[model samples]
Target: MAHYRASESKREQFRRYLEKAGVMDGLTNVLVALYEATEKPNDALDFIKQHLGPGADSTDAEGSRVELSELQHKYDLLLEENKELKNRLLQYEPAADHRGVE
Candidate 1:
């Protein structure tokens, strides 16, 4: 009887912690979405792994290479965008300053 009460108290504390942390809602949503999408009973484990695993961060060389190449391409694209925005800002600054002087 004493052990049962202690276990119940621990369970209640865990439930309250999950509710306070907003984890219940997020976890419920993820599990529900996966359940709705699943066609077979075994798909739940696969879907969970696909959604929550390291994704592309595998230890294999090909996976590492692919991730590295993708990140490099994104970095290059952002750098070009930054350069274009700076050029446009320079073009606008002179006009704004000229108007302020008048």
Candidate 2:
């Protein structure tokens, strides 16, 4: 129980420190936007740059990400189907008779 209270006290102190630094609100807003993103970014650094840098996209980023994912799924399905068809074709090739064809 003592350890738990100590942990909670430390958390409050850290929260107060963040609030005093004036960075808590900015961080919270940035994190909320990241949460609302359709395609979650893997790299936090790159994600921050895309939002705060001059090269940020004026177009819809989530829409583009969704379209790209759809295309990738289609590509994977087509590739698997192609592999199956190739295996089926190989099975249909007439086997050469060893009596004279050899």
Candidate 3:
């Protein structure tokens, strides 16, 4: 009975330590996000890493990815439009005088 109590006490101490360090809250939030994800990630470990890995302070990994993709598409479209506009402008601009002779 003494041995059992000792083990239980150790476990409790460890749980408190985790809670005090904010590990419990962080993990709980991550798990809840994963559970609510519409499209499950193929790699569960990778998903966790993306949310909890280095430089990862946010929990909405999926949302971030989607936003990034949308931004990239918009940037591409804008770049193409800018190129077209520049080409059109070039057609009207006066040609540069290349001859140095007066």
Candidate 4:
């Protein structure tokens, strides 16, 4: 029982961090709490229905999921862009190469 409580505490801490980081909204917070409580997504959906009042509709949940997906997509694109930029910069010729100063 102590271990279960500790795990629950950790999950709560993670949830709080996620909220404070602005990564999710109140409805999504309830969704995540449901997820943590049941470990099954269907159970999480049910929990959301019970706990999230009128905000547990498919549209809102889908919107949150889409936002997370889009953020991930943007992050991937930025990483690729940064890598390409770094490679391009690394390929530049030094001034010494043109002057033959060595």
Instruction: Put down candidate 3 lDDT per residue, 1-102, tens digits, no spaces.
Output: 999999999999999999999999999998999999999999988888877787485547677888999999999999999999989998888557853666
Clashing pairs in 3: none
- The list of candidate 1 runs beyond 4 A from truth reads 38-42, 53-102
The segments of candidate 4 whose C-alpha lies over 4 angstroms from its true place after superposition are 1-55, 93-102
Model 2, which residues run further than 4 Å from truth?
Answer: 1-55, 94-102
Give me candidate 1's TM-score against the actual structure. 0.42
C-alpha RMSD for every candidate: 11.3, 12.1, 8.8, 12.8
Q: Which candidate has the highest lDDT of all?
A: 3
* Native-to-model Cα distance after best TM-score fit, residue 2 in candidate 1, in Å: 2.3
lDDT per model, in order? 0.78, 0.82, 0.89, 0.78
lDDT value for model 4:
0.78
Candidate 3 has a TM-score of: 0.55
What are the models' TM-scores?
0.42, 0.38, 0.55, 0.38
Task: Name the lDDT value of residue 27 in candidate 3.
Answer: 90
lDDT of 4 by residue, 1-102 (tens): 999999999999998998897657876777667657645664555666676566647788899999999999999999999999988886785554466645
User: For model 3, how many clashes?
Assistant: 0
- Please tell me which predicted candidate would have the highest TM-score against the true structure: 3
User: Cα lDDT for residue 8, model 3?
Assistant: 100
